[model samples]
Each structure stands twice: as C-alpha cells, then as structure tokens.
Target chain A: DQQVKQNSPSLSVQEGRISILNCDYTNSMFDYFLWYKKYPAEGPTFLISISSIKDKNEDGRFTVFLNKSAKHLSLHIVPSQPGDSAVYFCAALPRKTGNQFYFGTGTSLTVIP
Target chain B: DAGITQSPRHKVTETGTPVTLRCHQTENHRYMYWYRQDPGHGLRLIHYSYGVKDTDKGEVSDGYSVSRSKTEDFLLTLESATSSQTSVYFCAISESTTGNTIYFGEGSWLTVV
Candidate 1:
C-alpha cells in the first residue's frame, strides 16, 4: 500500500511563474516531511523539509507548507527556472520509525523557458 | 557533497545471476538506506542499516538482501536477477544531527536480462 500519494503525475509551467506540487499521506504518525528534486539518470537530492511543528518553511525560491490535520503538504517554487525542470518527490517520516521514509509516486515538473 | 559513492554505477546481468551493489560513505552517518526507482513508482525502500552488523528490511525487500559489516560500507545483493528487478538504485545516508535530511548518492543502474 502506498502511504503517500501525489495525485498529479505531471505539471507544466511557464518560466518565472509559480509551480505548486501537492502531496498527501494517509499515515497520521508521520511527523516530518521532505521534498526531493531528481534529474534524469541522477539520484534524488534534498530540496526542503518541514517539521510537523511548523506550518511552513522557505529557502530562497522554494517554500514548503505542511498541514498536519489534513495530512497534506505542498511545495511551491517561485520564479521557476528551466533548470528546475525535473521530477519532484515528497517523502514522509513516521514519528516512531527510525529513519524509514515513505515516498510518493512523484510529480514531473516542466519549467518551460 | 555528503561523500557517498556507489560501485558498478552501471551493470548488466543475466537472469538467475547474483549481483551486488556497494555503497560507501565517508560521513559515518548512523542511517543508511537502499532505494529502487522505477517508472511511476518513484522510490521504494529495499533495506536499511542503522549500525554495523545491524540491518532491517523495508517495504519491498523480497528477493533482496543487505549487509553492513562496517560503518562505511553497505552492500545490497540480489539473490537471483530477474527482468522485473532492472531499475536504478540509490543509496542514502542520514544522521540524527541533521534532523531528517537524507543525502543520496549518484545512483546505480542495473539491468537484468
């Protein structure tokens, strides 16, 4: 069973626009969430993360928002650049599971230049 | 860079053959993970190790085994290569000090014919 789900398989956005990727999880025990960016033939890289205690976290052009009650999270990339075009994955870590993270199917984001 | 490396970055093996992919890390992180990436599946955990001589299975552990004999080395072995097992594998490392941030290696591509 997939504990995490990314409803959207793909999304396209014009350069310099805001790109929002959404993810939902069924497990309420998940207390930590993260976003990873992956390019073709490469491993997924850490992008941003949010603790259950915080509703939002931002770094530069990237922002992550978490809603614990809804078991949902979204990643927003403002002024999306061509270089940002890649597959984005959202992962969740349960409060008691030691270092075990469940990942969503992923959303392919295309930032058209 | 987190100083993680995967050996045999690309490999091709025949059915029933045994294959092992090695992950070496210099960070000495307490947590090490092996994940497989497939189309529409995103990333699925195969196994993980928390310390030397300690290991645990993940969501999709069938037909796969892992060992951690030393702090720097984690090995993932496929008992019998199957066509369905052909996919890209990634190794990740995380430490408690980092607070849920996991760093991934470049990735290893394996093909079972």
Candidate 2:
C-alpha cells in the first residue's frame, strides 16, 4: 500500500507566481517529513523538511506546512522561477525507525517563463 | 551524489534475460537502498541493506533480489527481466543517525523489450 500519496500528477505556473505542491500520509507514526526536488537525469536534492512538532517551516522562498490533524503537508515556492521547475517528492519517516522512509508519488511542477 | 556510483548508467535488455545493477559507495555508509521510479509511482523501495549481509525487502521486491557482500557495494539482480521492469533505478546511501538523511545516485535507466 502507498502510505504517502501525492494526489496531483502535475502543476503548471508562470514565473514569479507561487507554486504549491501537496502530499498526504496515512501512517500515524511518521513524525518527520522531507521534500526533494528532482530534474531529468539527476538525483533528487533535499529541499526543506518539517518536524511534526511544528506546523510550518520556512527557508527563504520555500515553505512547508504540515497539518498533523489532516495528515497532509504542502510545499510552497513563492515567486517561482524557471529553475524551480522539476518533480517534487515528499517523504515521511516514522519516529521509531532508524531513518527508513516512505515516499509519495511526486508532483511535476512546471514553472513557465 | 551521496558518494554513490551506479554502473551502466543506461541499459536495454530483452524479456526473460537476467540483468544486474551495481551500486558502489565510497563513503562506506551503513545503509544502502534500491528504488525504481516510474511515471505514476515516483520512487518505490525494492530492497535495503542495513549492513553487509543484512538486508530486507521493501514494497516492490517481488521479482528482484539484492546482495551486499561489502560495506560499500550493493547489487540488485533481476532473476528474469520483464517489460514491466523498465524504469529508472536509483541507489541511495544513508549514514547512521537517529534521523539520518538519505542521498541518492544519478540513477540507472533500464529498458526491457
């Protein structure tokens, strides 16, 4: 079963606009959530993460919001740029595991110029 | 790049053939993982090794087998290739930590006709 799910297959937005990617999880034990950005032919790069203890985490132009009550999370990229266009993946890890993670299907965000 | 290297970055094989993908890490990380990426399935873990000779299967481990003879190398073998197995394979390494961050390799693209 897919413990983590990304409902949206893809998203398209213009540069300088805000890009929002969403993810959902069913496992209650997952306490740490992470996001990664991937490009064609390249490995995914870590973007930002949030501890379940908090509701939101922000780093410059990128922000992650977690709603434990809803079992959902979202990544927001404000003023999206062309370079921001890539497949974004959300991963969740349980509090007890030794860092083993479960991943969502991923959402491809296309930031048009 | 996670100090990880996957051999034969791209390969095309025929159904019923046997194929092997090699993942080598220079960092000697204790955790190694194999995942396959597809259009709708993002990244699905096939197998993971916590240490040399210690391994476990993941969600999509049905037709695949893995081995870790050395701390730095993990090998994934397809006993019999099938067209459905065509996808991009990634190898990741993680350091031991209460909350370790996993890193991935460039990925190996495999196609079975």
Candidate 3:
C-alpha cells in the first residue's frame, strides 16, 4: 500500500561524482513530485520539485527528471560534495488529496571524500 | 526556519499512558501537519489542520488525535501509548494546500515502553 517507493535503502558514491537517486510511484493521480533532504537530527528540507507537465527541472546542482509513463522520477546531483550526504526522500502530491503528500521510505546517500 | 518548534524534543512514557506533543509556529501559516517517521516508513501523516478547529485525519491517524484551538499552536495527543507508537514526530507548516512549500520543525522523539 505504499504509493511511493524508493527501492534502494542506501547508496555510496565518491565526492565530485554524479549521484543519482530514484523513486517510483504507484498512484497515477500524483501530479507533483518533490525531493527533501534530512540530516541526522534535523527535520527534512525542501530540495527540488517537478510538475507532471514538465519532464525535467534543474536548480543549481540538483536536477529532477520525471517520466509519467513509468511513474518514476530521479534526482541527480553533479559534483556531489560531502555536505550532500544525507537521507533523501521523494514525495508526491496527489491531486485532490488536499496537499497531504505521500513520501517514500527514503534513501540514505553517502558521499566519500 | 519557518518559525516552527516542536516541544519536548525527546520523551519516554509507559504503555497505556497518555502523551501530548506540542507544535508552535510563529509564521501563522494556514496549514499545519503532524507526521511520524519510522524505520521502514518515511513520514506518515497523522493529522493536519487548515484553520483553527478545522482538522482532518491523514493516512495514519488511528490511535491519535489532534487539536488546533489557536492558529499558532497544534497539539497531537496519543490517548494510550503503545510500544509500537515509539517514533519521531515532525510538525510541518504551509501557507496553502497545493503548490506551496512546507517547512518542518526539528522532530520530537518519543519512546514508549
């Protein structure tokens, strides 16, 4: 019954490399997707988002790609830095759900310097 | 960040006892939410309010109740604590229901024994 799923629980990559995180959703009614980053003790912070109408959105070093056909989206960070190491969650805003977002289990990313 | 604060950052309670967690926001956002994060689950919404005394249940609202008597404060109550209810709770605020960014407070960790 998890509408959104992040199959990978964790990932590791070298600093300055491209880090990609993937997410999939089972609900076709979801029209908006967002990414959030969380540190050990702090709450999650907004990263980037993409609408269903757009295939890709980029902000600085963060890029999100959406494929409506596959019900999948991904976040890509180029030149990943040590500071980027954190748990990344993918969430969706279902239409008519009153902005109550559905979030994935999250993927922990580790960047090694 | 977002002027949201979750009180009693950490607490321990015995089973069958009642517990209440407080979330206070200074921004006066129109929307407030309570969510719990577990190991296998990301952030599961417990309840949310659009205005004072206008509250609604979220995906996981059983065994929990929420009250919003004032715009600046939202309270989440666990009528009878259970060991399975031990988790970190987060409070979020947003200005609108859709297409609006939500901000989260540093979570409150509750341990039920």
Candidate 4:
C-alpha cells in the first residue's frame, strides 16, 4: 500500500502566480515532511521541509505547510517562475523508521511564461 | 553537490540477467538508501544502510539485495532483471545530525527488455 499519495498528477500555472502542490499521507507516525523538485534527466533536488512540530516552514519563494490533523501537506511557490517547472515529489519520514522516507507519486508542474 | 555519484547513469539489460548499480558518496554520511521511481509509484525504497555492515530492507525489498562493506559505498543488485523492473533508480545519503534530510544522486536509468 502507498503510504504517501499525490492526488493530482499535474498542474499548470502562470508565471508570477502562486502554485500549490498538495500531498496526503496515511501514516500518523510520520514526523518530517519534505518536497523535492526534479527536472528531466536529472536527480530530484531538495526544495523545502517541515517538521511535525511546526505547521509551516518557508524558504525564499517556497513554503511548506503541514496539517497533522488532516494528514495533509502542501507546497507553495510564490511568484512561480518558468524555471520551477518540473516534477514535484512529497516525502514523509516516520519517527520510528531511521531515515526511511515514503514518497508520493509526484506532480508535474508547468510554469508557463 | 552532495558528493554522491551513481554509476552507469543509463543501462539496458536483457530479462533474467543480473544487474548491479553502485552508489558512492564522499560526504561520509551514516545513512544510504536505494529507491526506484516508476510512473505511478513515485519513489519506493528498496534498501538502506545505517552503518558499514548494517543494512535493512525497505518496502519493496523483494528481488533486490544490497551491500555496504564500506561507509562510502552502497551497492544494489537485481538478481534477475525483468521488464517490470524498468525504471529510474536513485541513491540518497543523509546524516543523523541533519535531521535525516537525504540528498539524492543524479539517477540511474535501467531498461530491462
């Protein structure tokens, strides 16, 4: 069974707009959440992360919001740029598992210039 | 950027043939992991190592084996390749002090015919 899931397979946004990518996980033990961005023929790169203790974390134009009660998390990119176009994956790490992360299917984002 | 390297960035192998992928890291991180990315599966953990000789299976450990005789190297082997195994594999490394944030290598694209 997939513990993490991205309900949307893809999203398209205009440049300079806000892009929101969402993720849901079934395991309540997950204490850390992260987002990764992957370009074609390249490895996924870390974007942002949020600890369970905090509801939100931000870095530059990117922010991650976690809702433990709803078992959901969302990654928001403000003033989305064309360079942000890529596949986004959300991953969760369970507290008991030592660095064993569960990843969602991924959402392909297209930032149209 | 994390000093992680994955060998045979691309490979095509015949079914039933043995295939091995190598991951080397210079970061000397205590944790290493192997994950496969499929169309709908996103990325699923195959195996992981916490120490030089300490290894453990992940959610999708079947048909896969791993070895970590050195702190800088983690090897993943497919006993017998199958068409269903055609996907991109990723190697990641992390240290405990970094809150278990893993860094990924470029990736290895494997095509099993």
Candidate 5:
C-alpha cells in the first residue's frame, strides 16, 4: 500500500517552457509536503515545502501547490533550464507521527535545450 | 548541505554475509534516519533515532537494524545480505526546529549477489 504516489515515472520538457510534476497521497493525516531534487551520485537537496494550513508556496522559480481535498500536490517550475533536469521527489509528513515522512517513487525530469 | 557523511559508499557482498554501513554527522543533529532506495520504490524508511540510545522502526525495517550510540554516529547493519537487498542507502539528519528540512548524506550503494 503506497501512501504516496507519483504516477508519472518520467517527464521531458523544453528549456524555456514550464515543467509540472504531480503527486498524490492516500493518507489524510499528512500535514506537511516537501519537494527535493537529486542529481546522479548526490544526495537529495531540499527544494520547497508547504504546510497543510496553506494551499500553495512559492520560492524563486519553483512553486508547489497542495490540494488537501483531493490528496494531491504538484511542483511547477517556470522557464525550465537545463540545469534543472534531475529526479524530483515528493514527501509528506503526517501530523500524528513525530514528523516522519513518506516519499513518492519520484519523477525524472529532463529539460531539453 | 550539512556535514553528513556516509562511509563505504559502495560495497558488494555475497548472500548470507553480514554488512554494515555507517553514517556520521558533524552537526550533532538530534534526529537521524536510514532509508533505502530501490528502482521502483522511492525512498523507504528503514529506521530512525530521535536521540542517543533512542530508536524506532520505520516503514521498511524488516531486514535492517540501527543504533545511535552518540550524537554524531548511526549505523545500519544487514545481518544476512540477500539479492533483494541490493539498493542504495541514504542517511538523513535534522534538528528539532527544522524537523521537516531533512539533510541527506551522499548515499551508499550495496549490491548483494
């Protein structure tokens, strides 16, 4: 039983366009959501995060939207650059737990210049 | 980018052999976690420790064990390696204030044949 799911295994987008990655979670107890980016042979780095109290959070070129009603969330990057190409992971933190997290299978994003 | 370090970044072992991976942090974070990443499964939690001598099992703690003797060191041991256990392992640490902002180590790749 996958508590968090990222249906799309991979996505490719043009360098000057927008790239959107989606994720879904089956648990309603999740109160915090975060996005992390990973490159080959490196550890995942924190990108952005949103709390359940809010529906959306933005940081520079990255924006994350949370839809609590649908148990869905998305990460959007504008003016995608070649350097932005990497694996993106969606993680959720349920309130009941002591901030433990659940991660999605991850989506590999490739930006074509 | 914290001072998280993982030793034995790459290892290969035969079935039935025991192997151990070590994660050391210079930041002295109060929380530590061990996660394994497989191709289809994002990052599954193996175990976590809230403080020295305090630990708990995560979602996928079947074949793994963890111990945190001091604030800077946490270890994961595979008593009997198996082919199915071949995957990349990651160690993450976070302070109590920024509990959601988990910092990960470079990761250790283990291939059990």
Candidate 6:
C-alpha cells in the first residue's frame, strides 16, 4: 500500500497566480516533511521543510503548510512564474526510523505565461 | 546541492546482462540511498546504507543488490537486466538520521533492451 500519495497528477496556473499542490500520508509516525522540485533532466532540489512542531514554513515565493491532525500537507507558490513549471514531490520522514524517507507519486505543475 | 555524482549518466544494456551503477559523494554523509523513477512511480527506494558495509532493502529491492565498502561510495547492481527495469536511477545523501535534507544526483538513465 502507498503510505504517501499525491492524488492530483497535474495542475496548471497562470503567471502571477497562486498554485497549490497537496499531499497526504497514511502513516501517523511521519513527523518531518519536505518538498522537492525537479526539472526535466536534473535531480530534485530541496525547496522547503517543516518539522512536526511547526505548522508552516515559508521561503520567498514558496510556502509549505503541514496539518498533522489531518495527515496532509500543501505547497503554496505565490506569483507563480513560468520557471516554476515542473514536477513537485513531497517526502515524509518517519520518526525514529533511521531517517528513511517515503515519497509521494508527485504532481506536475504547469505555470502558464 | 550536495556533492553527489552518479556514473554512466546514460546506458543501454541487453537483456540478461549485468549492470552496475555507482554513486560517489564527497560530503561524507552517513546515509546514502538509491532510488528509481518511472512514469507513474515518482521515486522508489531500491536500497540504502547507513554506514560502511551496512545496508538495508527499500520498498522495491527485488532483482537488485547494493554494497557500501566505503563512506564515499554506494553501488547498485542489477544481476540480470530486464525490460521492466528500464528507468532513471538516482542517488541521494543525507548527513543525519533526523530531519536532514536529502540531496539527489543528476540521475542515470538505464534502458534494458
């Protein structure tokens, strides 16, 4: 069974708009969450992360919100640019598990110009 | 970006042939991982190593084996190539078992014909 899931396969938004991508996890043991952005030919790079103690973390145009009680998290991009178009993956770190991470299926975001 | 590099950025091998992919890191991180990316499956872990000569299987470890003789290198080997095994492989590194950032290599594209 898939412990983490990105139900939306794809999402599209116009420039200067807000884009929201969601992820859900079934495992309650997960306490740390992260978001990674990947381009066509390159590896994924770290975007932002949030620990269980915090409900939100923001970095420039990117913001990640976590809701532990709901077992969900979302990445929000304000004033989305065309360059932001790519596949976004959210990973979860299970507490006290040697830092082994579980990844979601991914959501392809297309920012239109 | 962490100092992670993957060898054989692209390769094509015949069926039943053995292939090995190498991941080298200069970060001296204690945790290393091997993951494969496919169309539907975002990124699935094949194996991971916590220390030299120590390893553990991930979600999809079938038909694959891994070894870590040194802190800087982790190897993933496909004993016999199969068409279903064609995918993009990635190597990742992390400094600690806590909420450390995971960095991925550019990736190695492998095709089994």
Best lDDT among the predictions, by candidate number: 6
Whole-model Cα lDDT of every candidate shown, in order: 0.94, 0.93, 0.94, 0.94, 0.93, 0.95
What candidate 5 gets wrong by more than 4 Å, as runs, is B97-99
For candidate 3, lDDT tens digit of each residue in B1-113?
A: 67999999999999999999999999989999999999889989999999999999998999999999999999999999999899999999988766677889999999999
Docking class of 1: medium
CA lDDT, candidate 4, residue A25: 94
Interface RMSD of each: 2.0, 1.4, 1.1, 1.8, 2.0, 0.6
What TM-scores do the predictions have? 0.98, 0.96, 0.97, 0.97, 0.97, 0.99
RMSD of each: 1.1, 1.2, 0.9, 1.1, 1.2, 0.6
Query: What's model 5's lDDT at B85?
Result: 92
- For model 6 the TM-score comes to 0.99
Query: Which consecutive 10 residues in model 3 chain B have the weakest lDDT in total?
Result: B94-103
Clashes counted in candidate 2 amount to 0
Q: What share of the true interface contacts does each candidate keep?
A: 0.65, 0.52, 0.70, 0.61, 0.65, 0.76
List model 3 lDDT by residue over A63-112, tens digit each. Answer: 99999999999999998999999999999987776878889999999999
Q: Indicate the residue-level lDDT of A22 in model 6.
A: 100
Candidate 2 structure quality by residue, lDDT tens digits, B34-88: 9999998999999999999999998899999999999999999999999999999
Collision pairs in model 1: none
Model 6: per-residue Cα lDDT over A26-84, one tens digit each: 99999899999999999999999999999999999999999999999999999899999
> What tens-digit string does per-residue lDDT give for candidate 5 at A1-113?
88999999999999999999999999998888899999999999999999999999999999999999999999999989999999999998888577577899999999999
> Could you say which candidate leads in DockQ?
6
Candidate 2 lDDT at B100 equals 61
Model 1 DockQ (Cα-based): 0.65
- Over B1-113, each residue of candidate 5 has an lDDT whose tens digit, in order, gives 69999999999999999999999999988989999988889999999999999999998899888889999999999999999899999999987633368889999999999
Q: Of all true interface contacts, what fraction is found in model 5?
A: 0.65
